[model samples]
Target chain A: MITLTHVHKSFGDNHVLRGVSLHVPKGQSMVIIGGSGTGKSVTIKSVLGLVEPDSGRIEVDGREVHEGDRDAFLARFGMLFQGGALFDSLPVWQNVAFRLLRGALKRPKEEAREIAIDKLRRVGLRAAVADLFPSELSGGMQKRVGLARAIAADPEIIFFDEPTTGLDPIMAGVINELIREIVTEMGATTMTITHDMTSVRTIADRVAMLHDGVIQWEGPISEMDGADDPYLAQFIRGRADGPIEAVR
Target chain B: MSGLLSPVAALGRSMLALLAYVGRVAIFAGATVAHVFRPPWYWREFGWALMQIGWLSLPVVGMTALFTGGALALQIYDGGARFQAEFAVPSIVAIGMVRELGPVLGGLMVAARVASSIAAEIGTMKVTEQIDALVTLSTHPMKYLTVPRVVAATLAVPVLVAVGDSIGILGGYLVGVTRLDFNAAAYLKNTFDFLELWDVTSGLIKGAVFGFIVALCGCYFGMNSGRGAQGVGRATKSAVVTASVLIFAANYILTEVFFAA
Candidate 1:
């Protein structure tokens, strides 16, 4: 389980996160929904130690992550970045097996390649594509490769940052389904940050709406449509005029 | 008048912003160095960086030295003839190449080729969010990406300087024996006699420092690069310019310290 307590982050004078708190119990999928630039990504990055909070506490599996142990803490989690950040110089297989190829998790080259190929297969890619570079693949294919790389080590926790941002609806649905399947199979604690309602409906067990740097509403995916909160209602309906627009 | 001052104020703000960014870059470069000696070296990335920054840079470094040596000989002979001290050509050529031109021009050529390439490659990766990806994957991007290149550059440039110095002297020898009316044995003797251990050592030392500067500027500008094509272009240009300037500056300082007499 990962817990964020009173997380506050600011970029100069812009207070992106103001006393934000959230929790994801083990083996649960928690989706954070928010408009762009409302600190959704910042929140996830803070948990992963990508963005150091100005003041907060992020605890992973009962281990408190302060200043010095971020790398050790992050090793327990897998993340799929928004743009599918695969290394271009490396072939697809090596990109997937990067962690396994070095340091404490070092494995023999052939064994690592085998593991990478299996992950690729799990993500619905052929063995041949493993030797190709990320640039050689289509956008949808790249996302799948990113997914394979994320799950290569079978992390205890997973983070998906804007997983379906640029994909077509069908591809988005496919990725969401894959995320759902992987989370269920691995029984991992998953936190997905996305603005897409379709993704929330497909992948999220519980959805949390982020507004004004705070989680305004959170509940089961089934309860999202019936949410009585005006913000949630306005967001779900995709309306032009609501309490949200009035703030502008 | 007040309206006109607004542009000047904006310019000042931009300069201050740039200065702050450079300060952050220096801190990041120091962090990269601190991570370098730590365990968990990325041999795959290190090997790739060796090939990219060093081995592949050979042709340009070699060619620049060869041609510069040839030109230096010709110019020295021409100038020496006017003073009736033409006999000093071979000795002067050897000293010039080893002392000043060999490391300085070699560093600049590398600054042009290797520095720009490093910046562009890493800058594009930044724009594409590969560095962010590394961070997300429990990998320190500086340790994985920048350290290897910096190490490769630091270790490789000294060897390059030694090779370049030899090739440059050979170029002078070739031009002197074939084109100029000079005795091969005497020219070789003069070069051997004029070249001292300190001259060559100083150049090699300069090479190492210049290499660090080159790789540092490249990685620093690249990691802090803005997003887009223009951002990459700016990063590449700044990397080369800063590397070249630093090489020249370091060359003078090292030379002064090594041979102040």
Candidate 2:
């Protein structure tokens, strides 16, 4: 479970988040949808303490996000980066088993490899692909590898950033389905940020729409369609013109 | 009056920005040093960096040292001939190659090669969010990336400089014996007798400092680079230029420390 209270962030003159607050209940799939540059990624990053909020409180399991040990705090979470973010110098297996192979959770090399292969299999990747570099993989395959890595340590919380971006429709659907299955199987709380409406429909149990640095509307997916907020309606409908300016 | 004051104000602003950036780099350097002593060290990354910053740099450093030594012998021989002092060539060449040229040239070569590669690699990583991924995975980027590289270069470049110094002395020997018509025994004797252990140690000490500067500039510019392709390019360029300038400046300061009364 996570809660953000009155989070505000800014970069120079451009204010990104202003007094934005949201709560995610435990083991729920909460996807934040928004237009480009609506600070969706910043929100997720703020909770993870990657982006320091100017004024706010972020709590994970009732403890402040920045409190306690960093390694212990981070061990509870995993993230699938937008670009997969695999180390080019490392082979696929090493990338997937990165945390397992090093730091506090270090395991024997063989054990790490075994777990990496198993996670790859869980993400529908062949065991043989483990030795290849990230550059050798296709975009969809890379996303799957990112997925495998995110779930590698069996984290209690997983964050997906633009998981379906740059994938073909079919591949996107496959990733969405895999995400749904993994979240259910692990019972992990998730906070994903994406502009993809289809991904929201497939993966979200509850949805929040971000606009103008605040959560404009948020509720169950069923209620999202009928939400009267013009900003939310315009966003879901993919309109170029609305109360929200097309260009910022 | 406003027009004349405008240029002064602009200059003042630029100077402040430069100082601010230097302060940031100083803080980053301090943080990197702090992380170096911490646990969870990445030995694998350090080994890779050693190979990149040390072993891979051998051929270029060797070649530069060789050419510089040969050239130094020729110039010293010609210059000594003016006062009928051509016999002093061996001692001069030995001192120059061992005490100055070896480490300076070797450090510059490594800076050009290793520094650029590190800046480009890490800069691109930063832009692509691999660095962010490292943090998310509970790995400190300073430990995983910066400390390994800085430590590797600091340790390895000295060894490289030692190797370069030997090859450079050999180059001077070959030139002095063959082309300069000096007897091989006499030339060898002069080289050995004129050189002190302090000379070699000082150069190697300079090498270590130069190595630290090179790697620190690379990693610093890289982790602080802006966004996108142009940002990476700028970081790479800045790394090389800054590393080169620091190497020269450090060389002078060290020379004064080691030799000046």
Q: What TM-score does each of the candidates earn? A: 0.93, 0.98
DockQ of candidates 1 onward, in order? 0.65, 0.88
**Candidate 2 chain A least-lDDT 10 residues:** A239-248
Stretches of candidate 1 exceeding 4 Å from the true structure: A246-248, B1-26
The candidate that wins on lDDT is 2
Candidate 1 lDDT, B1-261, residue by residue in tens: 999999999999999998997788779878988999897688878888888878888888899999988999999999999989888989998999888888898888888998899899999999987887887676777888889999999988888888889899999999999999789999999998978898888888888888888998999889878889999999999999989988888888888898899
lDDT of 1 at A173: 92
**Candidate 2 per-residue lDDT over residues B110-159, each given as its tens digit:** 99999999999999999999999999999988899999999999999999
Query: Residue-wise lDDT of candidate 1 within A164-232, one digit each (tens)?
Result: 989999999999999999999999999999989899888998888988888889898889998899999
lDDT of 2 by residue, A1-248 (tens): 79989999999988999888899999999999998898999999998889999998999999999889999999889999999999999999999999999878889999999999999999999999999999999999999999999999999999999999999999999999999999999999999999999999999999998899999998999899998999999999988788988863
